[model samples]
Target: MSTDGSAESRPAIDSPERIELVHVGRTLQSLQHLRVVAASLIVLYHTELQITRLTDGIHQHSLGFGAAGTDLFFAIGGFVLVYTSHNRKDTLGAFLYRRFARIAPLYWLFTFLMLGILLVAPSYLLTTKGDFWHFLLSLVFIPYPHPVLGIDRPFLFPGWVLNHFAFFYLLFGSLLFLTSGKRVFAVSAVLCALVVLKALFRDQSHLLNFYGATVALDFVLGMIVAWIFLARNETPWIIAAVFLVGVSIFATGVLQNVSEGAERALFWGLADAALLFVCVSIEKQWGWPECRLLSKLGDASYSVFVSHLFALALVASILRGLRLFPTLGVPGARIVFLGAAWALGMVVYAAIERPLMRCIDRQRRPRMARMIVAKGP
Candidate 1:
């Protein structure tokens, strides 16, 4: 669930302007493709679950492992944050604002949409229910016990990952005051300290538990990957072999039903980091030709992540209403649901997300230009 600006241009890694590159211009096509892959994994996982429910467990699949895609996304988020911000002269406010502008508006829109459905069509929602405090906390990316489930989920359940992302953004943004080199080390130390504290004290508080989760370590893994990416290139074949090994380990863990916590972070998180490292390394080493379709899907991966629940629910409802499941069967229904979810996500991206981003960029660029000119290069 990431977005990059401009897909057509490719920048040389050692270009003289690299240090001054505050905004990400040249898109990393490999990352874009990975975004699509991660989002699709999640969608497929949910699709399998939906099929099972529709079939009353008569037909079931093990794509529940696809939930590990969240780990992949976290790693990607960490990598992108560092890759874009490192060596730049971005102020804390500026860095946070950019992150907020990119993430919040669409998230808020989807949150409200979910809220409205919970209010007017409560039955339409599978697991979420409307609660004022919970909804409010969700909008601000706070972790609170869900009213219905009593778990630390936002009103839009998938937004749980966003809460972690918001935390990461704050931590990363604060570190922007330091030199880029020191920033990574500082943030990594802070995250490590938090994890250590959690292990030592075993705090049961929702906030502490959420922040202290070992999954947070995935971001550190990604930061390391970014540092490596910026520092030196690895052998492409070795990276590819690492990628294959990562996939094998990740798949094996998923098949074995690895429980969440340290195990998940170690298995899925490490695999995702390796996967991301490979993709970016390959792209940097030997550029990939643009595939517009995958690129577009990658661009909309964030939209897909946020809006997919709605799409899946809509598809499920329509299928149930039409009595299509029995005719289509579990496999067929899974395909329809997955396809519909991705299609709706792409539609949301094109119709809403893209325009919203452009509007934000339009308002932001002139002020940014003034600031740049004022700096007097």
Candidate 2:
């Protein structure tokens, strides 16, 4: 439910039937909330080591398993595209318009802001002379814009996820053409192979050209979800499906090995997805309370994800001097700090992220001028 007492994950004001009490319906909404909460977990779980010029200071810290948030985000991206467009009669032009409206405005705003920062803070730019094309190509989101050099931290780290999403949009749309055929299994199998092979190669620079190949399997899995449930409305056996996959995910010790590329890719991608499927199926079998606040949290989740990094930086900077839990030791300090990080993230989303999103949405998707003859005065 949204904070305004409306249901979350339903299409919008005009699409009420979208909020059915069906098993898959419930699961989709539940997945929406789950994605929101999980993305927040990412911000809390990551610890960035502040580099100070001691004889030897840790220059970087792991983001922990927060990359799972990316997987969840990617999965949700595919889910929403299908969820929103599944039954609609959309023209190609209208389809592209809606898709562009959903993503482009805020993305462009962020990209331009990053560009400004790069211009003003030249030190942040890549030492390589070719970054101009890389930055431009990255924005266009085509097949491998490597001449531009890969992302630099603080400014561009978040943008890589955008790259994943751009391609996923293309992937999902291309599959949309096969409305009469069921090639979902074939699609997923191919993408899974691509991801595993890329992981085996294990080259980060290759990520500049081919990172999408690594994560394409997850998006393919998302399509599999659409094919099985949305296409068939196959709800009765959904639980059994979820149970089998859940056991496999757990038995493989996937979550514990978040460090391994192939392992984490398969683990979280499968886990988040199986979790989504189970929740949706359960909802179909039952009804839920109208939780508006949670719905709003889900709505603002994108903002929370993009802005959380900055919020974390702010919290880390402020907490640097306090040293309250320092005496308690690193792990203890990390625990307390994680709690504070989430609270701060919520504040940042409310104050900055949501408002900016509103502006972006309004600026894009202009209403066509209705043909109204000038009234005779």
Candidate 3:
């Protein structure tokens, strides 16, 4: 796939040419599959939260483990930024523009929608307030304490992740002036410095504290994995074993409830980096069967990640209003919620996200054509 997140032409996975092209550059289906998994895990985690809230803590099991999906996402983001940028000549403006265009439009739509909800029916919202400052800051991707929630969440809760991504993009994009090797080294060095500084000084400033978290290192881990991936070809069994080890470590972290600070980064972040490495490596060596539905879901994963909260809230409201939770029970209600969330996310992807992206691309294409004409062949 291209750095703009567009799929590229690929030879059939079973073909000899496809195996040869794996090293040259081919779409790793495994990453797409993992994207679906990461998005669904987040949806499930949030659904559990909603369920527990509605039931007043009556729900038994916890899907809090699913929160590690964020870790997985961070790692994947790092890997992708490096992997896609490989052997390409992308100007800094183009890199930042593509990243922003990919994430911002859908996020802005949801932010405004949340603001509308807060204005028209604040009761529908659980914690977010109708604060103009909070909404404004959110629009610009600035981290600020939410008025009611008192956390660094935006009007749209899922937008917090985008704020992190914004930071990562800025940090990464600035390095595009350098060679790819230097860019990687610079990003790794800068991220590590931030983490170390944060650990040493323990600054209280919200932005500093937020950016200083060890979670930033997940991206560094991802870059390292990408470097490894590009440097060597490993046996499928070796990659599979690495994958199992990653899963075991991740499962251990989840079971132990290691969900914060350096421990979370060390456990979930490292494990996810390993998992991503395995996925991309193994898929490159030995092809995966085409699953159109899952691939579609993977394409919509970003939409799902940002919009699932809205979907879950709507579903929960309907279920509660109809008094169906009693009849359906926790498990059945969760199933309904998960299914509805995915359906709504896919719809949003089809209806809003894709159109917005195409519109942006159309605008860019004309400008690009003009530039090309002016530059002359």
* Model number with the top TM-score: 3
CA displacement after TM-score superposition, residue 30 of candidate 2 (Å): 0.9
How well is each residue in 1-377 modelled by candidate 2, as lDDT tens digits? Answer: 43222122223331121222213333345755765666665664455343221103543444445566667666666555555555443345445544554555556665676677667865534432335656666566544434444432223456566666765565555555554133355445656665666656656555532643545666766666655556444455757778688668744643364642555657777876776666655655664455666655665565556555555555555556574434645555556555555565467556755565555434432332121123233
lDDT of 3: 0.78
Q: How far is candidate 3 from the true structure (C-alpha RMSD, Å)?
A: 4.3
Q: Which lDDT values do the candidates have, in the order given?
A: 0.79, 0.53, 0.78
| Residues 200-314, model 1: lDDT tens digits | 7776576877888888988998888998988898986789788898989887887788746667787888889888888888888888778988877887888899999888888
TM-score of 1: 0.90
Candidate 2's error at 211, in angstroms?
A: 5.0
Mark the 10 consecutive residues where model 2 has the least summed lDDT. Answer: 14-23
Give the runs in model 1 whose Cα sits over 4 Å from its true position. 1-25, 57-61, 372-377
TM-score of 2: 0.71
Superior candidate under TM-score, 1 versus 3: 3
- Rate residue 134 of model 3 by lDDT: 86
* TM-score, one value per model: 0.90, 0.71, 0.91
What TM-score quantifies how close candidate 3 is to the native fold?
0.91
